[model samples]
Target chain A: MSLNESLDALRAKMTSEAAGAYEEVLQRLDPRLLAENALKPGDVMPNFELPNAEGKMVSSLELLSHGTLVVTFYRGSWCPYCMLTLQALDLILAPVPGQQASLVALSPETGGRARFVKDKYNLRFELLADVDNAVASMFGVLVRLPPLYRQRLLSQGIESETLHGRKGWFIPVPSTFVVARNGTVAHAEIHVDYTRRTELDTLPLVLRALRQYS
Target chain B: MDLPQIGYFIVLSRVLNFTHAARECKITQPALSRAIKRLEWELGGDLLLRERSLTQLTEFGRAMLPLLEQVQAAADVARDEARQLQTQERAPLRLGLSPWLAFPLIGTVLREVIASVRSTEFSVSVEAEPVMRERMLRGDLDVLVGLRADTLPERFNQWQLFSTGAAVFLPRDHLLAADELIHGSRLAESVLLGASEPEALPERILSQIVRRLGRRPSTPHRASNWETSLQLVRSGLGLGLGLSCWPTPPELVARGLADRLPDYEVVVETIAGRPQSRAVSTFVKLARASAWMNPANVP
Candidate 1:
């Protein structure tokens, strides 16, 4: 199945299995507020250095020095939707190096969890651990999980502190940003609905446009 | 009185692009232009020389920039103080510290500050050097305790707290663990673990490595903080660099580098010439007086 199809299937199963929990989360999380606060196209992407799955430091400015940078912020490897998105991006990442662009995925998950995700998915690109969600917060993708949602996750044996190495129940809204070599955001897609994601096909078009401009 | 206009001017000066400045200020282009025009009218001087290709600050704009920054900073402080007062509370001094500094030293510094100012509270954050410096400049943090760097803005006043030499950390079973002194080039073949933040590693250590190897040492594994870096070294992923003052973990052995690198100085820094609240001033005084601030008292 396609990434979107798999994500949609998981979302459907989740909502049906726990309708009340889904409704409570939807009621508390205002998509409009998240969208407004999110970094958008034309914004200047902030410079940051984060540790990848193998614990290597990957820097945005240094990535741009090589070429354009494609950054994605996800919730965690445990999330099925995030896994689907990552797998899809992994396949798409095959051509990025040739296009003179580097792809990196960021999550609040600990280095161990990030390593798991990279190994499980056989990802070729960098999977960075945004410790304490510092970089995610800077990108305006970080949000505290609502109490009800936190309770639901906890009941399911998913303790955030164990997974993220931090006590706060916070996660980044799934976001994809294509930053040009000049540091301007060429394309940005922030999905309040965790299951939704930017299509892999659209990424190349954005990169091509940015390359043309450069 | 026109704080928004001053804000727009500041944004404009940094970006030097009207469209970008407007977007950053979340105002329409025409609105930003009008605000700047009004500001110029109020001051009776042109602030910018707008051209098709470039926007240059006028002589008056250059003269007024510092004053405007002061006004904005003062306004921010006043608003923050007033809000604290309304809540019947004193604003906790937001402090940012470098992650690689010895953790026990941080606890001691905090204890000193708290003991000196009984009523004051502190919210401490351990961040990378660049992030901490940025937060300090943005006024989000009141003080920064970290290694001194030449790259820091001239507006910050730094008080040297302590100085320590660099040490190399290796796994217990690593071949170099038996060495009393490890040569920089000897470890060139191993994956060097380091703090992810560039500034966390002292320049002298990197320079020594480069001078010995005829190239910059490649760090294959980098951790977000000192603890993680040390953990990587313990796991045998790579060697780690740390301050000699940091307590060596039971599983890791720290050896001094053969070539003497410069000592790293930990400093307490605050914005220069900025007005400080009573709580901030008290913290600064305590920091200055702390035993840690005395080089002679350094362990």
Candidate 2:
């Protein structure tokens, strides 16, 4: 099943009131602003360096130097939706040793946490720590999770330490981008609703198109 | 409810300038114009008259502005009420603890409070004294745990927690680290650190040193906050002054002042006559009864 199908199944389990509340939260997220500020298909991708799972610093410039780069910014291991999306990406984008394509995931969590997620999921892609959402903000995808949404997250079993960040629950808008070798954004997908994600099936087409730059 | 669009439109209605209106809404001009257009489409008809260098609300737009704002206000109030209802069930307890109390000391009080209180969910706000006081007064915070105030406003009911003195923190290998007690004059000998504006307590602490020693700090550099100041001190930048109650980090040892700085009284304050939630009242009671907060333990 696709990532959205899995998300739909998860949503189906929610009660009517819960579903309604979820809808309201997404509506208030201001998709219009996200569209205005987010990186476009032709926009140049900025270079950044973030700590990887093993505490090694990873640079976007170095990643692109190899080939096309597929980067996804997720919430973290705590979010079930993010978990499904990440697992989907891992299965669909399995790295081919010296192919002209690379995959990496970044989150605002610490490198120690990225290490745990990598180990538990056995992910092929390198997971990097974008401390304080520095990389996400560069892509114009960082959003301060509403206080009420944060409280709801806390009320449901998740510990405060996991959600309440120094800047108070900032998470990326669940964005994925394919950058060409020339550093221009070849393709971009930013999900404001979060329950929806960049369809994993589309990556093959986007990558095939990136063959020119590769 | 289309609150976002209508909210944007309402702001646009007032400013009568797309650029200025967009600036007010914190969105781009094109985005604001698009929102106004979408809202007009939804409500049926042109709501705004946009021509070369001219912006004005049409008759329908002017008529809808008040109604739209009313609807928005009603929506906001409903949302807030619902949030409060949801919150009342098992809301987050906002605890503002001043640096005047040590970490372990606050930890002990919180552990006991959670055990006794029905709700275990809580958030801690560590800020300068004036910010915390204003937050408490504005009802943004449930309770403020500490700040040595000689007198609080009549609107607040305060419980005296304890009296603790301030101390100087130094890197273990610093020249003055061997001194039995750091005198005020000795503190003036080195560079000092303090937080910049809006963090009033650190400024007050730094100022107090100048008043007693009768000289400004040799050369003071400002840090963003207490933690940053401590980090600078740990890096051996200079001496740092802070509440004696803050837990001393392993890298730095705290020393008392030979010149007695007046003891600071940490107090627990909440709005007077306001009905206290179980969490708030329980926290206050537990804090009051905590043995570590007892006044007799500190000199």
Candidate 3:
């Protein structure tokens, strides 16, 4: 099948699943939210109390109060692309002062599984576990993997048990953002897969934007 | 380097017609036409537009264009630095080679370079074009070898190795496995078990087969590599194509080919601004020498 047709089939499958969970989860959003960039510059970030890699509770407001924030969203730690991108960020942060923008990586994986990403990449940034994608849904970036990929990963012994010590089969699309000192998002980039990334050189431009906005 | 000439070449590579490229280049068609011929002669490759509608870049033309772009960018940077090449201390070379070439070619270059020059250390990372290109742009890698990359980002360089195309693999029990060779057109009717999902080389190979055979075969299974492709064939999914001369895969026998398909050219490339370290240069020299090592006939 063509790429579009395959994606359409996958979307139809997801629509059917959403119907079953319509009352509990799907109803929380306005139907038109998907077409919009949910978070914009100058918008206050929702004060979320998510757990970090070590299972300690960390509040978004606490991180913000310390310095500027660099909030990044990833599908999960299993992705090589995400691992590489995050590693690049980890390497560049020290050189770039960027007005003291502190870095934090958020993913759907929770608890010890979240810690694994930190340990694996030796990430100095905070790793937040956005369990069930509460934060990702708020940002309008959560989506289910197509069944083919879901089944493929499962058959390869990479089920959530291997990834997050659970059996869930959902993940968020990879995303990254530069939040200004006042908690407003200064820049954002979100892609469906790992191959595409916001280049590190692009970060300097974003930092300039934040400097102007702040 | 002339900016318009570079733009002309990029468009010419795509459309393959001087008139079309000139139309796109927005110059009188002849001026644009002359620019390309000049480019071909200036560089040693016959980057030609064959038949009125069809065009292909001769191996040399493809390799040199990216390097030319690098030279262009470096020239711009040097001008900014008072047009002095020696002003900037040469950056340590970061060479990127495909995993395949690193084993055979990169090792030899490393020893020669180390033996020759103890001062300069070449940092090398072995990865595929897709991954290596990403890192190369990030300034993490300086050069890459093997597999002609598609649409390298701005500021990257490419040097072409010859083209190497895909071939099929099958298990002994399968009917086609006993044959001396099988054409992709003939395999079109059969359920072809792919060794990988619908990604780069497989997609290109399968698309070519379907075009040649006039229909798409059912892809019952996909494996990530040659070994798995062989196993999937053995499992009765479909035939496979072993891309390399690696080991004989488990539970399958490779069939000989009477004829072969078109070859896909691979290349070595370096990111702009990163000069080759002594080691990387040595490696590139060795890789060019050994480009024909994979005969494309081994099972």
lDDT of 1 by residue, B45-115 (tens): 68899999799899989877865664455345434433333343453688887888865645654665455
Error of 1 at B240 (Å): 27
Misplaced by over 4 Å in model 3 are A1-214, B1-128, B189-191, B195-197, B227-238, B242-260, B294-299
lDDT of 2: 0.69
What is candidate 2's lDDT per residue for B162-242, written digit by digit as tens? 556778889988888899788888777788777675334556676777789888876457765557778889987877777
The reply for model 1, stretches above 4 Å from the true place, is: A15-17, A95-97, A198-200, B1-299
> Model 3: per-residue lDDT, tens digit, A22-71?
33223332224322435666666655545565434455666777666777
Residue lDDT tens for model 3, B113-192: 45433444677665546877888777687667656645667775554544444656666577776676776656767887
Better of 1 and 3 by TM-score: 1
Each model's DockQ score: 0.01, 0.01, 0.01
